[model samples]
Target: MMRRKSWQKNLKIAVAALLIIYAVEHILTMNVYLRKPMLFSPLFRVYNQSGSEPHCPSVRLSTRVLPQIALASYPGSGNTWVRHLLQQMTGIATGSIYNDEQLRHNGFPGESLSNGSVVAVKTHNHYAGKDYARAILLIRNPYESMLSLFKLANSNHTGEPSVDRYGKQWGTFTEERIRGYIPLFASWIKLQDVLPIFYDALKQNLTRELVRIKAFLGQSGIKGDVRCALRDSEGHFHRKETGITLEFFYSKKQRMAVNSVIDQMQKMFKDRFENIREDMDTWKL
Candidate 1:
């Protein structure tokens, strides 16, 4: 009985020892895997060919040989049209448009590209408080933007549900539906209320808007014809062959109110132009 009891005790100790060893081995393996660098393989290939590791500053400089301008605007504000025009003016290919995939690979903010001599990014997000170093804010008639948005919502080609169905499903039914047709419409409804407030602030100070843009670009030591860079003279406001038609559904008073709001926003930006220029001059590259 004593011998059998001793054997049982020894068996339990051995099992525990085996389990501890297995756990330790598993942890070490996982740790090594986690430590492996993500871009190491690509970096190694470049270094092997060049006989030196490329520095990040050099990469940034190369990407910024020409200023990297982002086309910042609200949705339905002719962003796509502006992108195409810029591509033509700069002689960059459409296939080389900066996007999130290239941005991630190049470590650029907001999935922008680095292939063009002058890189321009486009986005609709609000300015990064004061963190952005370069940006261009594009303003359009708010009424037109809303009209375009409504048409886009009503269409099926853009992979959105019909506006009539969208409105009913989401609540707040109008004779027309414009909900699922636009991306993230539910969230946008909340934003729409606040947009007029910000728009008024912006319109009241256009000069400030320009100055803020210049300051952001100046941080990269990029100084050029800022006016020409922002010009949209190519008459490429609409997509080619998309057959999208915009119809105004708002009453005259409502339309006028929208225009009035936009006008105020534009005027605000205009008033702050000098201040913006002064701010740009002070930013360090």
Candidate 2:
């Protein structure tokens, strides 16, 4: 009789503790539902207020369809940043063919290479799903882009910089990245299947570039709230302040090195180079 009483007391205590936890969690969830109404209200309504089917799922109608355009960029050219902007502005996610673990850690959604509902897909690979109408090629001057990439390779080395066929070392890694991409850029530009977007434009005037991105993606209704985008992106870990700047990255030696590489590519891809002829110097850099 004494043991039975003790067991009953312990069971009651456990039940009370569980009830307290459930109540606290309910309150917190309600707070979130109130604060972020756009994100949570609809789902909450479906689950809480639906008559017979309290567990009915919220139906989401996609605003855009995919097999969509690629937001293509070489590494360190702010590819992940632009993808975040799109995700925030539209609530549609960005994807990559490679499904890099690094990209996901930065808040990208799951692997979405074939997800047609995705708004924009990131790709560094040349020939992945070329049937997309056009690509938003995010270009940063190689001086900054390569330098940023080199710094990344050193601090948190990934296979990104070492993927060259010839096994180029860090001294020549930047040059090889530029040389390899010049021909690819020329070909894509010549085919007119790419809209070249300079990374500087996005940084300097976010709203203007946001408008361009919306126009390119054919979704101008969402306003592309630049202030909101900036606020939201401020907390992401991958976006740590790097102290890298355009003026800092710009150097005569870097310019001359890239120019030599571009010159070599230009000889072989003459007609193709004509596509972005005006921006070639910046591209050369």
Candidate 3:
């Protein structure tokens, strides 16, 4: 009888513990799903939202106004926005390797065709086209870029991931992307006549960056206005701002490893572009 009672008592305790655990878990889940904001909320209001400027006319290149220039950037590095700005400034449609149906219907009629039909083609691959002679390489902070990639992967271009998805995937996804940056930068650096544009700097000064791009493209006779492009700088691709916290998501060891790689890249850029003092500032957080 004593042994039986003891076993029964233990069973009772186990059941009570499980019930408590279930209750706590349910409450936490409710708090997350019902009360808390998303983990991947927009962390900064970097772009302007107002602009009634007529949609920039998208036209096919008749005589190859610019050389075979690739507008190169990693996924989620604001390539679409840059393309929009380029169209606004140059009045010529930008082409891309992947023909996104949404982009095609929305504004990018030059989607999927990287020939002379477009001024500069968009490419995410390291191995750009053999015919490509020059490129405008757009670079963004790895942290921000990774977050944007995660959102794009989990949701749409401008949407946030579910809290549960973020909890399960964000850490691993971020670490992998952070590591992937090394080889991406390494390969692209080899391509000759590459102009590196920092995304943050572009956000800070839209018109200035567009002017720089205009001069780089060497198409002075284009019928697009660089100053007018600034009025609608934040095109349809920019995600809505939800918050403004730039926290480091990696652990100490991982942070050190990523920083070491970034330091090497910054040094490489310094060697490549002598006037990169402002661009070097992008390495900071």
Name the top TM-score candidate: 3
State every prediction's TM-score relative to the real structure: 0.39, 0.58, 0.73
lDDT of 1 by residue, 12-97 (tens): 99999999999978875665465421211222232223575323121122333554444566665665544443343333322223
Q: What C-alpha lDDT, on a 0 to 100 scale, does residue 118 get in candidate 1?
A: 50
Superposing all C-alpha atoms, what RMSD in Å does each candidate have to the true structure?
Answer: 22.3, 14.0, 17.6
lDDT of 3 by residue, 170-254 (tens): 7788667777786776777788778889897786656556767888876523456664465456678778866844464455765
The local distance difference test score of each candidate is 0.41, 0.59, 0.73
How many residue pairs clash in all the candidates, one count each?
25, 0, 1
RMSD of 1: 22.3
**Candidate numbers, best TM-score first, in rank order:** 3, 2, 1
What is the TM-score (0 to 1) of candidate 3? 0.73
lDDT of 3: 0.73
* Model 3 ranges with Cα > 4 A deviation: 1-66, 219-224, 279-285
Give the top-scoring candidate (lDDT): 3
Could you give candidate 2's per-residue lDDT for residues 124-157 as a string of tens digits? 6664435566678887766666766775765542
Q: What is the lDDT of residue 32 in candidate 3?
A: 45
